[model samples]
Target: MQQKLIYILFIFASVISYGQVNLFMESDKAEYNGKDIVNLTIILELNGVDLEPQTRFQLPDLSKFTIIGSGSVTNTLIDPATNTLVTQKVSRIALEPKKKGKIKIGSVLVTVNNKIYKTEPFDVNIKDVVEKRSLATNISSEMYLNMEIEDREVYQDQPTVAVLRVYSKNMDNFRKVKDVRLPRQDNINVHPISFTKSEIDPSGAGNMASQIVAVFMVFPNEAGYVDVPSVSASVSSYSNKNKIVSNRVKLNVKKLPEGSPEYFKNAVGNFSVNVYNASKDKIEVEKPINVIIKVSGEGNLPDMYLPKIVSSPDYEVFSPKITSKVAPGTTGMKGEIFANYVVIPKKAGPISIQTEPFAFFDPASREYVDLGQKTLALNAFSHDQILESRTTVEKVNEYTNTLLETVNTPVLKTTTFKVKEKSKFHWNILLTNIAILIGLFIVYLLFKTWQKKRALVRETTSPKPLGSVAETEREIRETLKTDINDYFSYLENLKDNGDYEKFFDTLEEMDLEVRKQYLQSSSDDFRIRLESDKGSSVAEEYRNLSQRIQMEKYSPLKSAEGMEELLKAVVNLYSRISK
Candidate 1:
């Protein structure tokens, strides 16, 4: 009987796991004009899988339409029934029609957990567009503007995409248009999305062509009806000035669900929050460490309410250094938001670095996700008990530096100093002054004797002019030897921060500077100039060294060995040039 009971429970768990994932893809409508832009949305739902999963969405059919703009949103929620987390990802793609007909949108392939899933194929009917002709004027034209929005109704703070397209079959390109017009409305914040044009069919005889020129991301602030005014563009024509306008759009925004807590951050999208120590767990007293609170994924990161770092007697907290790198996407913005606080330990003991719990409502799941207070456990050590591996750290443990690292640190006087009430003469002070004068006199006589000997030696050696090539080369080489250490140190600092991209760029610049001075040539073709000045042997060495630098700078994997080898080659080339 016990064995049978275990088997039943196992089967029940397998059924829930199998039904946890769902994928869906849909288009704007079943019908469109020949020159219209079709919008596609792909959504992936995970009932209990990892909140942050590696996901990929691929549209297999490229011949049906030309993609103009694309953006995506990823979010997570808590499921009340199973007491588990759910993740949802929504991707939006805008496509321009390649031809007018009944075109089928084939199955879209999405990969999750290395497993493939496909959406059912659908068809869209495209009808021929009729041009509006004016019976009064003889001037002919086939030009107009169109706007395509993802959704006509959305809840407050829920994001939607609005794309603008231009269609022309017989008219020439607009001549004097400087800017495209968009609506300015209250209670809605308009965020612009950037896109690049892809290869598409150009206008020709008996051909209908259109291009998506702009996209705007809209987020409603309140509930009720909202009107997005029509976008317009005016331009000069040869016979008659023309003005084209797109159709207006209206949005239905519903109020947020009731029972939202007062402390609930007005955040409306999917996001993940974390708090951690930038360095190791053991911190030294009087030395700074970084405790960071980071929120990244999707949604309104810029306006979201982040929890504060609670002050404690175990550590003295300083003002936080915040850095945000957010760019516009399908949603208003998507990127990482960081707030790092620098703290110094006051005493040595096991301590807790924590913040208040964070709460946000997920519009899709209609539930609240309480990412409970982020707590990082750390051990504070006395100054003398600090580990050897972390001794060299002087800056704040994280990305930003603290006030203690500033060059001009404030100094507090321990005791006040006042002028002596009465002045007194001392024998030792008078003796020291007399001795310093006599020592200076003796040193001057020895210098004069050495100068006479150096003059005698120069008489036998031929002296070069101040501006002579030989003199210039000597000065340049001396400067290079002195400044190389400073250049190397800066490069090392970049390497420590794991900024390999900037390191290569700065190293390339330093190589060019060294070549300009040593070769004494500013021309771009350094090898040719070098060949003429020096023999083929010297130039050959420089050419080989230049090739090495270029390869290392562009290589996929760069290491300390590569950087050191390249710098040594440059210095060795200088030695050959001098010889």
Candidate 2:
């Protein structure tokens, strides 16, 4: 009977303890030695509690505190079997306290399951800070401009491409344009080109907030040294602050290339000229003969004029039609041109046609090059199938008058008996319609075949899925013996693949009963380090987990047996949120 009463008393005490929450007293306070240095700390503890795990403890605002300083936090785990947890947090500031006073520390609230738990308030004593010598600082993230050039030396009246670029780190936040100018130089002509300018995101390199790139085509009028004048512009950074700046560059010009051909006209690069005949042997009088002139190679073909084709004066020459195809290249543009001309036979003998040489400057070789002349041979017929009319004008006029008289005087011959005339059916028109329909059907079949081929190509070119986040996480979990880098790599891939909603769900689930138990029981510091590290930007929902662990002692309220279920629930929630 006595042992039974002792058991009953033990049960009663356990129930009372579980029903109560603990609120620790003023646990942390600090002092600074200068206007830039500050120190502070806080600690909270809970015993026999049944509140939700994902809860946050609110603290007082320190807006009066000037100049931010560094801070640190720590946490400890007590007895896991009893669900008892303890937490300690520490922070340091780089500013002296405004005035000495007894400040009231704010209350902290926590939730376990669905019930809310609260902590009692504490008093903080602030004292005067000592003075120090070394406290100077500055912000080096300023805006500025820069410039660049492609080539410095070119002949007078020669074309050159120029490039200018402006860069800044804070361009997106900048507003208003002011005093924009470019370097001024003599005998130089400039024209603007097209390109888009935009603000620099974090993905871009350096601290540049924004950048503008401009391109121009320039030509020099005379040979001499010329300076590109400085440029000035203004931009507003914040509400009222604005900044201005300028930049400059230089160039050198030389005389035009000597011995340049009259037809050259500042054309640049290499070329070749060739001629071909439509007929190799004899041709009938008045028959057309084609003189095909082809120019092939690399050059500025637009600026270069085709050399005139010269022949005997008696020959009938038709105007030439020129066609070209241009393709862009690293060194410059390279393409080809074909000029076609029709020549009619005049005299009945061998006719020789010649194509003269053409010259252009080779920019890559820095020298002038010429394409040699080409010659073509043609045979003219004397008097063959092509001939003038043989009938005399008087005879032709007499025959025309006779036909008109016949038409005016109608024939009046009468037949006694005549069989009824029968009309024949027109099969030629039906055959023509059938032929057109057959052609259209063949074209439709060809188009369908082409479309099938295109669909096959698209299917083969499409991208394939590698793996999902759960599969990767499982792989990482299996590699318990692998290096830490591999583990982190898998974790990063998992994080990147997940959407923001899924990420938050995963974080919340990680702080649950099973997850907390798994993390607390592990000897490795991977998950623990991520939770309590200085660089970790703890999400607002998971702030409670961090607050608990970053304290003086580590205490977790979850059991190890419940971990697997909690992780499964988290993974399910994450997938749902992502979808």
Candidate 3:
């Protein structure tokens, strides 16, 4: 008996040991530049317990850094050491330093078996931007950076292609390129198109060279002198690291000439306009007809707006649904813009729909170009006539009547016939119904069984409550508030994380919460608050931040500065409202 008891105790101890949980954390790099990305990974192993989807993991306090992205994976497998089943969850978090210094990340916490496990703290060293070293004479002189643009002068909102070329000799020996930085200027938007690397012809020294080109579609917001700043890139070779900088270029943007036609729609480029009716030449009165006007060519298709369709007494025109298929390329912008108008004829007659002449300034010609006027002739028929033509029953009746009139009709005397009654019940019918009833009964039984089994499974597998709904909501609100505070506490933290999408979603939620809490608050209160000096300042900041967020959300070009301003505005608004 004593031996049996000892055996049982040993087995229990083994099971307990197999169910233990372990956590570990590490970073890919110990040191990095302030602008460089650092990868951090956390691994959690569960000896026997299965990881539930609802299991909450608390991330470390990374206020000193920004989280660019986070992802996790969980796997269950047999552990080689213990030869037992183990479940592991691995999480990867990409972070960027907020400033140059020694940033310390606190312990990460995880809850298992109602107990919290924590990982040790870690530190990352961040350094400021280092100046580039000049290349040695041994290095080839063919390696350089060059900037190119299609046109030096363009109208405002006109898209121009800018190319940054990196030329390097000895293509086979070039190692890699890193820390590519593009220029950022106010009022000018840069959109990345493509980056390509290819082998080029040999230089005079009979050495092969490689060319790397990066293309961007640039748009100037205002008519003035817009400068394209120099681009910097670091090239790594077997010998050493060399930095290459391209020359800056200035662009002259001339405003659209005055006295633009009333029908002008801010279109700039070479384009052809066409107008046609989808219903062909025939249309029914008082019914909607689609009149499509398509403009196709190479230019700023996205920014082009279609002129208003001139309304006439014969037609009732509604708003046009506009769509564009423009793609920016190294050569230039190319695509088409389509404007579909819903037009309804008022009376039956020959209706002429005329479009105003479409005009655009041609930068190549240095003058305005007209696409000329367009006219669509539509024959409108009365609704009654159209309905009559479509009435099949009336047409069939008329044809039958005409046929009967053409043929001779013979009159006949009426006759009657007797019928016999039969029994209502039949053996074949009875058997068929009996079989159907049995089949239906079986189906019903199976359905009931399935429902019971599903209920049993749900009862057994339903997740246990971590907290009540009210408690969860309160926790969420607290987390959101903390995130909002942290958003501003760290400058450019949210932007660095590339969390604009989530940041705006959180802001919208917070705004809704504030409005819900202040249900009784009136607009007059906001106005009165704005009258104060502090309120005035807050209002201005709020407007500027809101505008920037809107622009960043919709515009092709996005900036970190806009995200920082938005966070500041959100924090400020919350503070003022709380007061």
Candidate 4:
């Protein structure tokens, strides 16, 4: 009976051991030599307990060394196959020994489900202060923010993008960064862009903490010299808990050149314009004529608008119907804006059309460049000439009808015939059959017409979609699973399937709460990037998204993981753009 009792006791002890949480300390050794700054990491392995998300866990505080920095909590996904949960917390600090003695780092306590768990304490030895080798500093140490272009050289109203990047040799755990001091220029617009912060992994050849990663974007503003002063950036270190600020950069802007062509308003970059008439020979006064102005080159094509044409009392004019096709990229905006005009001239002989000079400031060149215009030969027909060219005219004659139809003619009458009687059942059946046939015919015709209309609309908006926002979003999600190349393909399909109105509609429909979360300092700065008149990072981002969206047009499920990261970035951007 006593042996049985012992066995029961042993079994109960094993079960308790299995259920209890385990805590472990990670370091080279429990004890460290003098003045040695060690990275202290604490790990928790929980069994038979539910660990809630956002749970806080405390770490040991070393009496000898001061705590410098704490990292944000990171959770690792639990594998269903293992059915185990593991968590880790790390605190980094630079240690300076107060005296030569054995110092103890206290234990860390973690509470889960009202149960407290503690870890064993570790010790470090402090000896005489020896000359320690200099530790490596990050890239943020020497390299700081500077203006990519001179502040005084750029023209007012000219668009420019100032690129700011940290050229650091060693950087890790970078957090809490902010920058401001960019203002809107008079008549000029500025758009700033902030790229995602990323870390460059240490290659096997290097003995550094981290490599350099760039954060830069383009800004396209208007003409006229505008001041783009130096901007500041602040970055903090996790080890020493020290914050550092960077110097700003400047730019010089000039006004767009004058003498621009009549069709050259808002023109950017190198472009050549060609004017053509429908026919040179067969022209008539007051007859509709086609004037096709084609301007094509590299620059922001969306902002490009045609100049007005002033006409005298002899000629009537109408507004130009413009069609634009543009593709934006990291370099700048490039595309074509086609404008068609219909003009009616009163009389012929050299009607003058001014070849206005098209001017724009090139930020890349830091100078204003103008495109010279070419005039066209216009011919008009006179009214007399038009009348002489007429072939036929209608003749009118008056006549009276004779007494063939006297007053008050008798009422016309019609004759009716009687038919032989037939079987009532056969006649009723035939009429019912005819009615059913007519109904089916009508339905078929309606269905056909609807299908044709749908097809026609699809054809009209061929390259992109001008559809409902919900549908476009659905299509975008579906493309997530596609291959990289197919991702772009699917986006093209979605674009072809969507329209500009629907695009903004999707942005507007985003969850308002999600947007609020990103309204912090970093986000507020990003908003400035999106709204800058000199640049449109939002448009560039949308173009990139379009490529990504197109890649997984049909297989959104496959690209789910990649798309999640992309989507988060997009959400942040969309919020800024919406604002």
RMSD of every candidate to native, in Å, equals 19.3, 39.3, 36.1, 32.6
Candidate order (TM-score): 1, 3, 4, 2
Per-prediction TM-score: 0.42, 0.32, 0.38, 0.33
Q: Model 1: residues >4 Å from true position, as ranges?
A: 1-144, 169-171, 174-186, 198-209, 229-248, 280-282, 325-333, 384-579
Candidate 4 lDDT over 418-481, as tens digits, reads: 1225544455645664665567667878988999999999988858656898777556545432
Model 3: per-residue Cα lDDT over 135-210, one tens digit each? 3344436565667775766778677787776656656534354445677887776766654333454562335354
Q: Which stretches of candidate 3 lie over 4 Å from their true place?
A: 1-146, 155-159, 167-194, 200-210, 219-221, 229-248, 256-265, 280-282, 312-314, 327-331, 391-579
Judged by TM-score relative to the true structure, which candidate is superior, 1 or 4?
1
Q: Give the per-residue Cα lDDT of candidate 4 at 437.
A: 55
lDDT scores for all predictions? 0.67, 0.50, 0.68, 0.49
The window of 10 residues in a row where model 2 has the poorest summed lDDT is: 131-140
lDDT of 4: 0.49
Write down the TM-score for model 3. 0.38
